[model samples]
Target: MTSPSTHHTTITSDPTVPLVRIVREFDAPAEKVFRAHTDPELVTRWLGPRGLEMRVEHYDCRTGGSYRYVQAENGEEYWFHGSFHEVRPSERIVQTFTFEGYPDAVALETLLLEDLGDGRTRLTTTSLVDSFEGRDAFVVSGMEVGVNEGYERLDELLAG
Candidate 1:
């Protein structure tokens, strides 16, 4: 028998600022979770929603580095690029994220991995956009589905 989603992903927005935060707890260590994010091949294995094919053009996930990738679904391609501003292995990363569909709306994003001990981790990410409207648009974009499903895939990767 299978259980409902026990590993919940909390997606919240700041009422006073143009920021969106995603928090999730995983049954894996911080190092493992961090590797799943930084390693390009592992990323391609589970970066977005299921049923999509992802191809990485360049994924240099290091300080001052950048990356670009394409995710295709049903003959449609979605492009996203980002530049890493800071990278602290197993701890935190700060980057700039841009979706090619709306090039002008770039966001500053930060990823934090907290060690919960006993082989567990807490991942927290915050994305800060330029305006409340931009943030609202992102919130309304049905991003939770992609994020929740992607994390489920990550759980499988970490388990295996």
Candidate 2:
């Protein structure tokens, strides 16, 4: 008999900032999963809170490229922009994220995509922030919930 493998995930908070780590297994190949991230059209279809309206103002997803977008929730709009630090096709990507309202609070994000065989893929995202205050603010602001929801939407998009 073989035991089912389980994957572990962790989210930690420090005095200055917090780190969010997520690992999700998807029923798709790595290439397809990777495309969902780098392709603006695909990303726009699934990258925001489920009920919020999102508009991609600018999207240059290659290495050294940048992106900007706005999410409107209940008539309130939030602006976010980021620059791609690195892009490795079908494997990994690194980027810097900043909210327009909180210009000084920048976060570093690393995304890794791994193939789990049998046409399954495991995608892990790690986000590191600058200070504990910023981390607290993010958690209090429901960023975790939003991120998880976004991933769930991605899962559905990929399934389609």
Candidate 3:
């Protein structure tokens, strides 16, 4: 069995659910990267996974505010919503996430922005799911494509 620590994103058993992590870096400042996530207009531009378009239905990014968006893929819309738990400008954010298709499955995601001098930033997202099944579902949901592409779009956005 491969040790959990060896995985880039670990899948922990119940006892270790707290340590699962996912990290992604961006070639922009922490403030810009944080804005891409919290600004509805910017999110609508690049938040969807590959081949999909994201439509922001409602968004109020302040702490305790709620957000909703629909991702259209193959002519089908997948809805997602979450409420903000914490929001600290350019530093960190915590939110609760739930997908309409799997309403009961919820996850808490924390995003940490670390400034890497010279206009670069490191964004690490740690999502804690309610159960192992929830984590598996999230991993299998093709989120990687969307995430990577979104960052690419952000790069373009920053440059232009």
Which candidate wins on TM-score? 1
True-vs-predicted CA distance for residue 105, candidate 2, Å? 0.4
> Which 10 consecutive positions of candidate 3 have the poorest summed lDDT?
1-10
lDDT of each: 0.93, 0.82, 0.76
- Of the two candidates 1 and 3, the one with more favorable TM-score, higher being better, is 1
Residue-by-residue lDDT tens digits, candidate 1, 9-61: 99999999999999999999999999998999999988989889999999999
TM-score of 1: 0.97
Sort every candidate by lDDT, greatest first.
1, 2, 3
Residue 160 shift from truth in candidate 2, angstroms: 0.8
Error of 2 at 79 (Å): 0.6
Instruction: Please give the TM-score that candidate 2 achieves against the real structure.
Output: 0.87
Rank order by TM-score, top first? 1, 2, 3
Residues 1-160, candidate 2: write the lDDT tens digits.
2222243334455444477666778778999999999988998888866888888999998999999999898889999999999999999999999999999999899999999999989988877887767767876787766776777777778877
User: Candidate 1 — which residues are off by over 4 angstroms?
Assistant: 1-5
